[model samples]
Target: MSHADAGPDDDHPHEECGVIGVWNVADAAALTALGLHALQHRGQEATGIVTFDGARFHSHRGLGLVGDNFSDARVIARLPGTRAIGHNRYATTGETILRNVQPLFADFEFGGLAVGHNGNLTNAQALRRALVRRGCLFQSTTDSEVFIHLIAISLYSSITDRLIDALKQVSGAYSLVALSDQALYGVRDPLGVRPLILGRIGGGPGGWVLASETCALEIVGAEFVRDIEPGEIVVINDAGVHSIKPFSRQNSRFCVFEYIYFARPDSVMDGMAVYEARKRIGAELARESRVPADVIVPVPDSGVPAAMGYALESGIEFELGIIRNHYIGRTFIEPTDQIRNLGVKLKHSANRGVLAGKRVVLVDDSIVRGTTSRKIVEMVRAAGAAEVHMRISSPPTTHSCFYGIDTPERDQLLAAHHDLAQMTELIGADSLAFISLDGLYRALGKPGRDPASPAYCDACFTGSYPIALSDHDAAPERQLSLLASAP
Candidate 1:
């Protein structure tokens, strides 16, 4: 089978990465490397770091996890500086290769700038096309590079002014950390579509820290200060922190999926607990939609919390029906269809004794392409589940996500193609129900809230993209065709 069809869950959406930047530290590269390791779950395809050693900049980038990428002593030893920015990426806009790994460094008239980006740019295609028409060259397909070019051409009197000017023209989600020879800069887009937090370590020799999640700060022993406000920029230098607020106050619409799937459960974003939010989603699922069953079983990992909530709320018995093999690496390859048939079995195995002759209710976070749900259902039935029902904690994902998530095309979404009854048949489930959109928002503690609030961005469910699509239209037909041709 092709890579796209190799496993049922292979096509599920993937969020990009975690970014961490530090200003003026003795071992900037090493420190940033450790920070990236702590935030590695945000992305795992590749890692990169750029450091400013006062006089010049140094960089090391490669395709692999943080440990693998920085494993070579020669590579680590080569990067030296007191100010640095780092990135751990799971490719969303570009191919998973070394060339696309970031901490994208460039040299312009203003000197050198290195950036680590944590979210998607909705207007990148249009901007790139405009730049190309104006005689600019691009080395990678990633949208993050466009920001560098935008900064390169801004006709401001100083580097900071240029950075601000460049930011004004771009739209969409971004939580960025940039390092220059003399300073470190952190910025959040106007709508606050992504998360970026500020923190500080010790004193005197102490430095400022910028990261995508607050957990990274805790891991690095930094005290959390606050989130960098939307449309705001914070620059850290020898003189201390300087703040710039250029855009008008607009409604904030942070992506809700960060709490549901992307973030480390231990992290806090905008004061909401990721783990608590997920557990609440499960509780809401139980209140809004409960299925008759002898046992409640989660899909493993992401599905565990919601399952607990479902079990608790419904007063149903919860059992560990599936066992996950934590040691399976992304690169672990099985050579044939027979071995591949054991895909779910390899990653998760059913407990026949627990599920045998039992009516079961399986809880999963969401169903994107629907391939995995089918296999999961078949596995449970094979393990002697007399009747199997499916419950989802989140609303059906029908629209494609453009904000740094690797969701499949609109046509590829099972919800977009089938209703609940149709989906039940497709997945071989006796019954299926998803939490209502309102129910999900209420679970997140944003019930009846205005859609434009910073509380949540439900674009994947509602199709209300805050940024104008025309601004960065890359020709949807062309993009879809490419995906259709995926191997």
Candidate 2:
């Protein structure tokens, strides 16, 4: 569907994209398809794959979950190749539309290039303006397209050199995989604000795989090698892997939310366990915000681990007070204001038998707009909850995210709009509390220092972007011009 047709309620925020690239494989497209399935949680709106068959590039793209998009055997059979790249996108930057579905391919002077990207580009506006001035036409509003044009017009002779030069100019959290006829190239931004990993399968003449998460590797029967180091470019071809360090290495600032909420519990990011980290956050919440309660009820799915931790630490009974509707897909229609108002209730229903006459501690991952949280509180109270105390596992979101996450603009964040006391009243909760920055870090197993710093990118909470953003008010023309002339 076109972006203009999508309504606001249909445009829910999602994390960045998940990318998978495979080289010299007999079943590259199938391998990539499986990898995309494993990384589905990272993105759900659309999926695409571009494959290089010894002679030509074949591609398939559609707007929907990976499974739904590839359900047609004819669609999958059309894409035949030995090398391929796939993308599952969640629309962090641009609108969610078929035109923006990625594994974006371009027929440049050198041949064909397919790129799948994760993370937002901070200088996209400036870069797009620059590119536009040079007569570069853009089909999509996503920042990822800028990189394609940058590589297209570079002065360098080879694709690798042009890609390296193009990357040096753009800034922000990115873990990119680019496919040419002969090789697959993987790059992580200077600060490593996003996660990417490399893996291999089989023995003699084995192929290489690059994915946003290690879980993707496991799905494709590839053994994890290690994470792609920050600022490193890895090229995998028939001659074997080669590496280049174009940008200077800085302190790695992997997004902390990956551990707290975004990633699958079984997935390991930056040498840390996601499930364990979340459980620790729950325990820390109990230690710090000890509100008397009879039962600890998790918000469901993401909130379960933290709730378990809270219940264990507080010696409270853990009850499943909220039950989520598993059948609901991401793109549900809420055509009216009343339906929008009942959005949370449609997805989650309070178990009256469990919550009735009980003082409950409701645990959730984070509160962004606070609308959902408020509605959930009201639902629980309506179900006869005697008192509800809301506990957030992570710190309040105070700033906008320039990375892949689709957090609202600064003023829209509930924490930015109200103080703790005001938010408590607004959500109709007996009390409200968020885990401190230290508690968050401690939960992630990085205690004794700042939880929001040194190791993790907490820019959404601290307003300290690792990369400098271009002027926020830059004109559209100016922004497009910068993109064209990038590098």
Best by lDDT: 2
What are the per-residue Cα lDDT tens digits for candidate 1 across 1-487? 1112223335466777789998866777877888898888778888999988889999999887889877666777898877889998878788976678898989987788998898887777788889889877887788888988888878786878988988888877888999887789999988888889998865656588999998888777788988999888999998888999989998778888887777777888888888888888888898887877899998887788788888988999999898777766544536766766667667778889989999999998888988778988999999999999999877888878878777887879898768888999999999998988888888888754465453678777777677766543457775564344332
Candidate 1: minimum summed lDDT over ten consecutive residues — where? 1-10
lDDT of 2 at 289: 99
Q: Kindly list the per-residue Cα lDDT of model 2 for residues 1-487, writing each as its tens digit.
A: 1111123532223577899999877777888899999988888778999999988999998887788877677777888887999999987667988779998999999999999999988788888989999999999988999999999889999999999989987987899999998789999988888889889965658589999888898888888888899899999999988999988767888888887778777787877777877888899999999998899999877889899999999999999999987655424635677767666766788899999999999998888888778888999999999999999988888776767787776668787768899989988999999998877877777754453446778876666666776645255764464343232
TM-score of each: 0.92, 0.92
lDDT of each: 0.81, 0.83
Task: Count steric clashes of candidate 1.
Answer: 1
Evaluate model 2: give its TM-score. Answer: 0.92
Off by over 4 Å in 2: 1-13, 330-333, 448-453, 471-487
lDDT assessment of candidate 1: 0.81
lDDT value, candidate 2, whole model: 0.83
